[model samples]
Target chain A: MRHARIIFDGRELDIDIDANDRITTSEGEVLDVALDSDQITWLPPVKEPGTIFALGINYADHATELAFEPPKEPLIFIKHANTLTGHKQVSYRPDGIEYQHYECELVAVIGKSGKNIKREDALDYVAGYTVCNDFAIRDYLENYYRPNLRVKSRDSLLPMGPWIVDTADIPNANALKLTTTVNGKLTQDGSTKDMIFDVPFVIEYLSKVMTLNPGDMICTGTPHGIVDCQPGDTIVCTIEDICSLETRMVSEQEYYGDKY
Target chain B: MTANTLVNSKLVCVALNDKAQLAALDATFNEAPYKKPPTQPVLYYKPRNTWSVDGAEVEWAKDFDGNDVAEMVVGASLGVVIGKETCRVSAEDALNYVAGYTIVGDFSLPEASYYRPDIKGKCLDTSAPVGPEIVAADKIANPDALTVTISVNGELKSTFELGNMERSVAELISIISRIMTLQAGEIIAVGFAGDRVAVAKGDKVEASIEGVGTLTNTLGGA
Candidate 1:
């Protein structure tokens, strides 16, 4: 089963998508809207999502690409709710900055609350999996908390989900293929198997530091191929057997329109 | 500023806002990794799991091997509660968005480096104990001039002035809001100053701001 939340006809709704791509409300009433319809605005699959934990250089190859050594422990950072936007959304590329890139990642949504969770039982706490584009502006990067909020937590920088696919649906989650395309050109390709700290390990590691609650999401880090994105670029991120997330990059001027 | 009011709020905190801290690290800031002093506000997030109410008993941090760690640092500071959705606000208008002020006891395991997000040292469960009550923003004459004091076991351990901050409260809100929209009910924990005192298990810690009430908590035995 796949779950989604959307705003249609000025009404917010909880919906489910079938294997055949049929859309229905939680009450089983069929919705006549297509996933790509301009009539409906998509919200992030999880409503009022909790703390978002993002990994930094969780892939060994990605660490090598950046000329850094693989960390002995997980390099985790927290992103706030303001950074989130849903599929088919517009994200702003700030003016006078260089090297804004998109990172394709798999996001795991926590289903159960647990503290000091063991690695073996970590999967039991996961409700579902979705996809996110962890966008960053390298120009804002500083060594003090290296992927700081200025670089990563800008408004609408993270584009998440068409919807969430149940954990049961992806039996081999660690083996899925993740890819990203910019304006129809494939820019990144990798497998979850390459993650240095896999899903179960991260869940265990985080639970030790603090409680893991329902609606919390962990965005596992991206792979190596990251290319600079520009205004007017359409980036699509997809995880095999999960979902595709689309984002259109626009200038800050276009997004704020003289408001800023 | 009841715990219920902050149940859904996100606690955003700043680092190196204390002028004394920057003065101490002035030479190091010019070296490797940092390369130069921070040009913008350095921010971090304290998630919901770390939230605890005043008078709560917080557990001591444990090592990777599961043994109790000796002491946790006390990050005593003022907390600004946002009353409205704010984005791209100006310094002069920043205070209008504040609903009230309270004390925040940002407890953490002692760690030396500021180069990475210290999730292990700072984000322990029940680490942030906030508020006995909130004093309305209008009641406080000047937020920056307030004096902050830290006490442990009834002994006054440290005292500092909020005016020593590199960035004023209004400036912090204005700069942060420019990058991200701060929702109503969210909090901004203005950073602590100078050398912070550490507390051991069974120790009672109290942090008080001049206008805002004091927040007290105890470290439970491991």
Candidate 2:
């Protein structure tokens, strides 16, 4: 079942989409929620899931090109709830922006809960997958001592989901393609096939550090060729058949420089 | 943290269940990750009334009974409950420091947080829902690699990673032991992720670690 919690006439309702059914409203309320089409305020696909995490440099080719040794382990970071927004939300391209980038990744939502999960059985715990545009304020911070707060945990930095697509339907997850466009101009176009560390590896590696839970999100890293955008620019991320999460660039009032 | 990078940050011993007092701190602290908190763990003054009991039921305060101020968070965290007092143990010989585990959700004054309000936020009588049991360290193969999840009213709210964390549990004990000595019955929180949401009246929260059982509580607002 493709499960989602959506806003229908302003009420949050639990919904399940079937192979034949795509759109519907809240229980007993005769309403039509536009699912596959252009219309939505994009709230985080799930409400109140435990911690959401992001990985860096999981792709080998991209890592090497950027002069980073393919890490012996996962390079992990956290994204607070304040950073998450749903499809079609306005993503701020802060004032005096040096460079900001969109990382289109296949986010794995944990279905089962476990700690110290072994690599072999990692796939069994994944509930499903969703297309995530892990936007980053690249070069915003002075240096990468650790992904500092303001640059990483900004408002609406992450715009995810048109809707989650279940795991069963996606047989070859690692081989799928991810594309990014800012203002309809193609910038990042890459294949998950290029990833050095695969999905099961990330799950197994991360499980050692923290427990995975139902509704928790694991955002795989972004690909190279990331470019810049400005206000009035719309960034669209497509992962064929999975989702196409879009965000309109907006100017901000106080563009806080990286002090975090 | 390296040599001479240590000092004490004044912390207010605010009660978990008080609201008005906590709202005052929001304008001050910026939520920063404290992996290896300058050698000393995330230690400060614990509320004098803090206690631990298994399967014990909690009662509510009257002022919060009929109003919306009684909800509190279970301070579910990992800290090595010390076995014996040892001063200046080497980084290699720290294993003699075996004691056991304790789950905590004591009173916290995190105002401006979604689930954490003031007096009702951290101070509910039974808000510190602790234990059904405890685990020894020699038994735990890897202490720092564990992840913890917290859920409120059946919704997951906080996620934590112990591995890549800025500091490790053993490192915390070692760092803290350098200045102050480790004593028995003194529990230390390894540290927690800075993000927390709100919980309201009649809401139930469960904090679960992999090996440890769930720490459950029901909020009765002030």
Candidate 3:
């Protein structure tokens, strides 16, 4: 089943999507109101996620493209809750940044809480999966903490989800195809099969270190072929069987202030 | 409210940048992750759920090492509690944003590498024991000139001075504020700067700061 968190009729509602991709109120019996995509505003599927853990070099192709060896262990980093923005929202490009790129990734949403979860029991802890455009500002990138917080965790930088597809529906997560487009042109393409660390191992490895809470999310890393995006560019990122996320880039001056 | 509930505040752990501590860890590992200490403050979040106060008994997670009981490395560090919403504040003006200070007992299952920040190793529930009481920030005549000591069962294990920290409290706030807004009531744990000692079941671990009160907790199986 596909679920969406959206603003409908002046209220934030969790709506269900039918087979036809139509939004229906998640109440008993079908509602008379069927909202179109343009009529409502999208919010990230999870509200106030406890922790946002992201993988650094989970794809061999992405790792090779960046000229780094495949790590012996999962390279990970934390993105604060403040960075989350919803689908069809504006991601700000801070002033005086030369290189800003958009990373298309598949996000795992943890449902059941567990610690030291075994690989065999890993999938059982996953609630569902979604899409995330893990946007980064490369100008602030310092090798000190490569992909440092200033580079990855900027406000409104992470655009995630139009819907979350339940795990029961996506039986073969590793087989899904992921693609990203800039404006109207396809820029990058890959598959979950390219993941150096698959979903179950990622969960098991992380669970051994900390408790995976219900709302916490793990963003499986992006693939190769990432390219720079600028203000006024609409970037659409999609993962097969999950959801599509659309984000437009705007100069910080256009949204907040030039000094931000 | 019970005195036991005082530890519900947000906890942030700063990692690395202690010259002696890094030297110790670097020597123990076969290959050093960093030739020089990290230039930036590598920070991690300890959610409110991990908070535990004095006299509160903490359970070793059932899944930990598949044993009913487990051992942990007890790390003690100073914590700075934000008094106001601070953003893009300079180091010169950062102290004005601090409300008070406290000691935090940051316990973790032993692990190597600060590069990835293993969540399972650091964020276990009841793993972070904080507070005896908050010492008003102003009362700390020189926050940088203080000593921290850790003891297991009353036996002194390690002693380190805050003056050895690579970054001062004001610099940490200044650097962090430039990245994300530091809200009121949240804490920034000035990372530990000395050797850590192991504590297991029935061992009472105590971490004390010169000015701030000591935070003590006894480790035992559930």
Top DockQ hit? 1
User: Which candidate has the highest lDDT of all?
Assistant: 1
How many angstroms is residue B189 displaced in model 2 relative to the true structure, after the best TM-score fit? 11
- Number of the top candidate by TM-score? 1
Candidate 1 residues A39-76, lDDT tens each? 97989888878889999999999999989899999999
Each prediction's TM-score against the native?
0.97, 0.54, 0.85
Candidate 2 residue-wise lDDT at A70? 86
TM-score of 3: 0.85
**Off by more than 4 A, model 1:** B1-8
Clashing pairs in 1: none
Ranked by TM-score, the better of candidates 1 and 3 is 1
lDDT of 2: 0.59
Model 1, position A55: C-alpha lDDT score: 97
The C-alpha stretches of model 2 lying farther than 4 A from their native spots are A25-33, A36-39, A142-145, A254-260, B1-222
> How far off is each candidate at the interface, as Cα RMSD in Å?
1.0, 17.1, 3.5
Ranking by TM-score: 1, 3, 2
Q: Residue B196 deviation, candidate 1, in Å?
A: 1.4
TM-score of the first chain in candidate 2 relative to the native first chain: 0.88
